[model samples]
Target chain A: MSTRSPTPVFLDTLRHVETPEGIELSLRVAGPVARVLAWSMDSLIRYGALWVLLMVLAMLGEGGMGLWLIALFLTEWFYPALFEVYAGGATPGKKALGLKVIHANGTPVDWPGALIRNLLRAVDFLPLLYGFGLVAMLCNRNFQRLGDLAAGTMVIYRDPAAAMPQLPPGRALPPPFPLNTAEQQLLIDFAERSTTLNPERQAELADLLARQTGLYGVAGVERLCAHARWLAGEPT
Target chain B: MPLETIAAELRRRNAWEATDLGMVMVRQWLGSIYAAWFTVALPLFMLLHLVCWGHWWLAPWLMWWLKPLLDRPPLYILSYALFGDPPDRRQFWRALPGLLLRRQAFAALTWRRLDVARSFTLPVTQLEGLAGKVRRQRLRDLSYPSRGAAIWLTVVGLHLEIALDFALIALVWMLTPDFIALEFFDLLDDSSQWGQLWLNVVGFCGLSLVEPFYVAAGFTLYLNRRAWLEAWDLELGFRKMAARLAPAGRVAAGLAMLALGLGLLMIPLENFAAEAPSRSNPPPPAIEESLMNPLCEQRRVREVELAQAGSSIKQALAETLKEPELHVCQVQERWRWRDDNSTESPPRSPPDPRPGQWFAATIELLLWLAVGLFIAVAGWWLWRRTPRAFTRARQRAAQSGPRLVQGRNEITIPPDAGLGDTAWRLWTEGQPREALRLLYQGSLAGLAAQHGLPVRSSATEDDCLRLAVAQLANPELLGFLRRLTRAWQAIAYAHRIPDEADARSLCLEWPRHFAAAGALPA
Candidate 1:
């Protein structure tokens, strides 16, 4: 577990969390742009709802004004907390953007965590327009704002599991030589992403493994795809 | 540039993630990027302000308009930095002019000044050196997918700049003392030279912080788009695979060449034997033919066998594909109402409101009742505590006299007797527990009376030790107190008596710790 390289092996936004269940979950932390957009959308919804309520409440005079004030207080403070806790860790805006708030340990946020983060929004909004919060987010590796840092929560992009690519119709054939798991996965990924590459590029890529496959050019590509199919457990 | 040396891990990323990568890039190279930025920007800002002496407002606008020019140095630094070769101060200065003046600088500051995706497209001209129609076509292709994010980046950048500017002003206003009475509105509307100069300084500060991030984000977005369009990750993977196999491929080729060379050498030797007829008798016709073309017959047989195997394998594959598991079609059964029921029996009517209204009214009434009950309970509790609160002050006043209580025992020390001398006498008389108790009680009383430690009468040995730790400045005194308390607790609770030497040491050390604080006046 301590065999970390001095420099990172690869750089990407994907954060890997290992659960006690012995599974590694890869989460992509959403950056500031998407978060800001989602926040603006939430603000629009919150205030837009409040404005409509105010209009209806104004017709009822003083009592309506008091009720509108209470609605304003709730929307300003508890709106995000309630939605985040109950709505599978997403507010309506976050859901629209396919983002969710979760604990730093990759668990669903509980009531206290949700309330603490939302309450600290007042501090994150210091000076004006979340200026301090933006700076904090930019500085943090996880892109967590001050509220998020305090509450031990983070916003991650909720990516669904990608479906397997449909392989081209071909007879499954085992590779001439044995392949390790990484090499086998590479072959499978090549078949998966080959549709996006040009035929010449595909042939070029396959030509790299030509020595192993005992083939070259288009024939090499077909052989690798066949190997990929076999590795994927297609009946051979 | 070699892909392996690129600092950032490149993959297919959306525009926002690419921008985030740029943010990470800026963080990684923050010191160098800022040094590059301020090295040119600060001088340019001062020069512009100096030139526009009285018209200070024009300088900031000019500086803002020259952002494309200002943005190049950091971009230049980052472009090299991305490939892990960050330019030094010398290289940065040397590259500054080319970056500022080259690549359609005139168009950027003029018609293209308002380009919302300026940072995103800036790299097309500056880094790639594309220009004219070629530059336009490249940018159109790159920006096609990411233009919206790039525009939003600019929009967010603009807002951030304004927000920071006002935040700085607000911070200054807030830090001002109340007696000074500085007006916020006056600060904004001030037309004086100092005010205008202050605004310029704040604006420049904001740009200095945000411009590097803006440039880096755009650069990464451009990089991301290229990586996606060209499939650079796959190319890198292929390069890696080729490198890994290069040695094996060379060895196999060498071995094959050696085998062919040996076979060629054998061919002549065999033919010579057939020609010379060196054997006692002429070789058989079969042997002669086999020697003449040693590999031809074996190769033909192997090829024919392989062709047969290939056809059989194909036949098996085709047969396997016909299996039921390979062509599974799931049939899902779900109950649904018939689509055509003539008029759906009867037209749907509005829901009855009476039950729903009554339920809602009941909920509202329950909520009101809960609130009222809470208030009533709080009032009764306060009413019950009012009389006790008034008498508690009198009780506190009545209990002001000093009293020394050790554990559950009260020790009344004679006013004139030396506490250490009396405890020593008690120890010698076979009353170790009582002697230890007297030492403990006297130490607490001394701490409270002489050293002004607020030792409570009910404080246990642990509590006394804690208070002494907090209040005592002398280590020797604190150490003495710790030893005395431990000896006392051993005899009092654990019923373990101390050794004679230990008992004598405590009696001697007690005065040094407690009596030195004027616990006993000689």
Candidate 2:
């Protein structure tokens, strides 16, 4: 994954992790807003759970409050840690939001990391609410809280990808200039993404090369299409 | 799949947003064509579903939930139309079975958009031919920004739907007969009987009205994001330019034709060899060497300027220092027998004159001077270690994170009057920040002026705080200074206003702490 410093704040980055098997994995770190929503989900779950615990343990009278206190302590502290360490690095709330916690190295977070992050919530809570935590998150690229920073972990989306649509049918045409790998990739990129872009835009973009192509307007776009077709191994 | 989605974005990108006129154009182009087909299918699906399941609400949900499946033909239709390919409605039907058989079943069930990325979702998968982890990575990359757009677009669509629906209902109420209007209100009053029915009807209508723009927006975001990541704009521009450049095109064509022509000029090797069979070796040509020498230009000049070897920097430095004529002496404690053992002191033993003793004394004097300078430097370095070193030690005790510590260079502050009184006075005079600045500056100055603490000019407020906290002997004073620094930093940098009471208390409390900050070297 490219470290997206100096890139726009809006653009969420993909962390490219090469697994032990040598396969590259892209972990898309979730932003602050998404994490907040996930945290809300987890909190909601915790509320309902404690409510149930209160009703169920009502049977034991005075002793139940003691049990409830213990349960509350466990639920508040251990709930997130256990889920993060054991349940594939996510609480139910995070899972619902399609978020997972992982080490900065893209490995699964260990117990220490999970514990440190959760424990720091008290400190991260700061003078009022999660003031420090929020500031830390906004400043950090990965939306990491003080806990995540201390623990060396990041939260990312676990979304799967859909297959790409088939390329548009066209006859291949040879390019007018020699291209390196990056330039060649651009041609394929245009073809792949052209379906999502407007034709007027495609033409306008194609027109930018009047200085180089000598061809103006429609011819340039047509030429680009031909080059794209050729790049994709379509019929000449 | 949907070229208009890409086309629309190109339009939008070309002209930032003309009140979303491009969106209107795109919707007019793609939405009108697709919605007609969607409308035609809706009644038939409704009738069939009503007979099977007995709920008309299921039809629109089915229409929406089956959007991923439904989008395929329309995408093809839009793509073809954009490319000027012949439109074939029959092809849409023909491809239906293939789409059903091959497409991701789970993607059709992306009920909520959060799951949109999780469902192996969208035109990216269908269009890009990537599968498994690679596709997943792309989807993961696109999800955040796309979801953001999707959310905004959905809101817009819903608002548009509400406006349109409200206008339609109002127009109907105004134009239609009075009896129907009364009946509609009566039906609304009986919410239990007609509530779910009205909800389904309104919801479906709203959804149908919004779905086109929503889908278009989503597709545009997805495609545009890919374009951005892949730099499609640059590539297409270059390819088009390169086409006109003809870097290898017409020349290669000409070369191909030339090669064909050259083939006709080839001789039959066997026949040529037999016709001219007589072989002879030629003698070597005689070599003639020329004896002429090349002419060269030359210029005459006076003697080159040079410095005398003895006149160097070393001698100059010696001359500048001006070595002083000095003598060294050795004094020994000498005991002499006192005859009377009286209080009268005997004459102090003086060094006896010895040859070459003056030279030895000079060398020894130089050695002593060197030792004195070293001692001074060592004392200064030791003195420089203050509270800042302690703060660093405390912070870096065990697993001290290797932070790129900012501002290591210390600054020298001019110790003004009393640090505490000056800070308190400045703070009370409504210059709170300046007050804190004075306190920090005074404390630093006190460190240097009183205790010989070395300070670099580059040190920030934080550096001063850490240094003060680590160096100060008293805990109460240290804590007080820490709070003062924290408050000052908040106000100075973050623009936070400390509570008047807090500020007042701190102002009053600072001098006491400032007094304690005057640490002396051990």
Q: Quick one: best TM-score, which candidate?
A: 1
Q: Relative to the true interface, what fraction of contacts does candidate 1 keep?
A: 0.33
Q: Give the distance in Å from residue A10's predicted Cα in candidate 2 to where it truly belongs.
A: 13
Task: Give the per-residue Cα lDDT of candidate 2 at B497.
Answer: 67
Instruction: Tell me the tens digit of each residue's lDDT in model 2 across B1-522.
Output: 322223332321211121122234234354444553474446645664566464644555665565555555444444444334424556555755655446554544543333433212456655565667896787777665555545544444455555444443443445667656454354334244254455545555654554544444455555556556545556444545455444566675465455454343232333433444222322112211111111100000000000112656534433322223311111223465667454455576775777469879999999999999999999888767777776666545322211212233232333334555666677778787776666565555555545444444556767766776676687776677677678777887898867777777775665554455434211
True contacts kept of each: 0.33, 0.04
Q: What is the C-alpha RMSD of each candidate to the true structure, in Å?
A: 26.8, 33.5
Residue B15 alpha-carbon offset, candidate 1, angstroms: 2.1
For model 2, residues A1-236, the per-residue Cα lDDT tens digits are 01112322212245678989998887666654456667778988998999999998888999998899899999999999999999999999888767899998898999999999999988776533464665575456566889999999989876646665356677788765555455666677666666766677677667765544567777777777778778767768
Candidate 2, true inter-chain contacts retained: 0.04
Off by over 4 Å in 2: A1-28, A59-68, A172-181, A209-223, A229-236, B1-522
Candidate 2: interface RMSD equals 17.6
Tell me the deviation in Å of residue A46 in model 1.
1.1
Clashing pairs in 1: none
Index of the highest-DockQ prediction: 1
